[model samples]
Target chain A: MEARTKAEVLRRLRSVAGHVEGIARMVEEDAYCIDIIRQIQAVQRALAKVNDLVLAQHLRACVTTAIRGEDPEERERVLEEIVEVFEAAQKI
Target chain B: MEARTKAEVLRRLRSVAGHVEGIARMVEEDAYCIDIIRQIQAVQRALAKVNDLVLAQHLRACVTTAIRGEDPEERERVLEEIVEVFEAAQKI
Candidate 1:
């Protein structure tokens, strides 16, 4: 991971963690149910963003290199991995 | 993605989605608060597992290939991406 990307992801995750804790507190305090669910959804979306950035970095660096390389095995492996990620994304 | 990995990830995600929905219902019924939080934590852990598998596939294919390739740029890029992932994992 690039240092910048690492820093960004960590920062976002930390914020998400705090958000989760806040939601938990809200629940404990008997806050509105729909509001709590909305917060959870927000955290999930934030996580999805982090996943997207990480996957993009993988594509730009690792996948591109494998596609450009001479070895058939490496190329096949990288392609399969990329397909897997896409499939997972569809599930999301 | 390899066919097997794709199938497994999809199946797991489907289950997790169901689990999440179940949690929502529990909340609606005003089920025990601690129990609901536990379920949420379980879903989060399940997601982390999916992320791990995707990351492992990246490492085995893209990162390994880049590290072995002749292009210094590719090598450096992959190494940095990996470091970033590790840093993010630590935040988790």
Candidate 2:
């Protein structure tokens, strides 16, 4: 992964971690239920953004390397992994 | 939210907080990008469950109270809130 992307991803993930802890605090304080649910949704949205970043980075770096390399097995493996990722992502 | 639901929600959110922090550690360690994305997806699934619990509690208690109360305005407000939630949720 590029240094810039990794740093950005880490920053986002750390913020997400804090947001989640904040949600827990809200629940502990007995805040309005709808408000809590909205916070949860916000976290989900943030995670989705992180997921996209990681997947894009993977495709650009790791997957590209494997695909352009001289190993047929590695190429096949990377192709299959991409398909698997999309399958799992459909649920999200 | 009810006491039991609140406790469960808090427990889950705390665990989610731990999981998000763990993902940040994975990134810091330069773990595989696909693996990090999968971890992000797992956290999202956890958040969705929390959202469901909070929404169910709201519907059963808060929304029910509003609907059954003498204030028609409160009932309309709650109904609109639910609709808005669903519309937002459709993208997720």
Q: Give the best candidate by lDDT.
A: 2
TM-score of the A-chain for all models: 0.90, 0.95
Name the runs in model 1 displaced over 4 angstroms. B1-92
Which model scores highest in DockQ? Answer: 2
Q: After TM-score superposition, what is the CA distance of residue A42 in candidate 2 from its true location, in Å?
A: 0.8
Model 1, span B37-76: residue lDDT tens: 3455566666666566556666776778788899999899
lDDT of 2 by residue, A27-65 (tens): 989898888888888888888899888998999999999
Tens-digit per-residue lDDT, A14-38, candidate 1: 5665665565455456553334434
Lowest-sum lDDT 10-residue window in model 2 chain B: B83-92
Error of 1 at B29 (Å): 42
* Model 1 chain B worst lDDT run, 10 consecutive residues: B30-39
For residues B1-92, write the lDDT of model 2, one tens digit per residue: 79999999999999999999999999999999988988888988888888889999999998999999999999999999888777767777
Model 1, position A15, has a per-residue lDDT of: 66
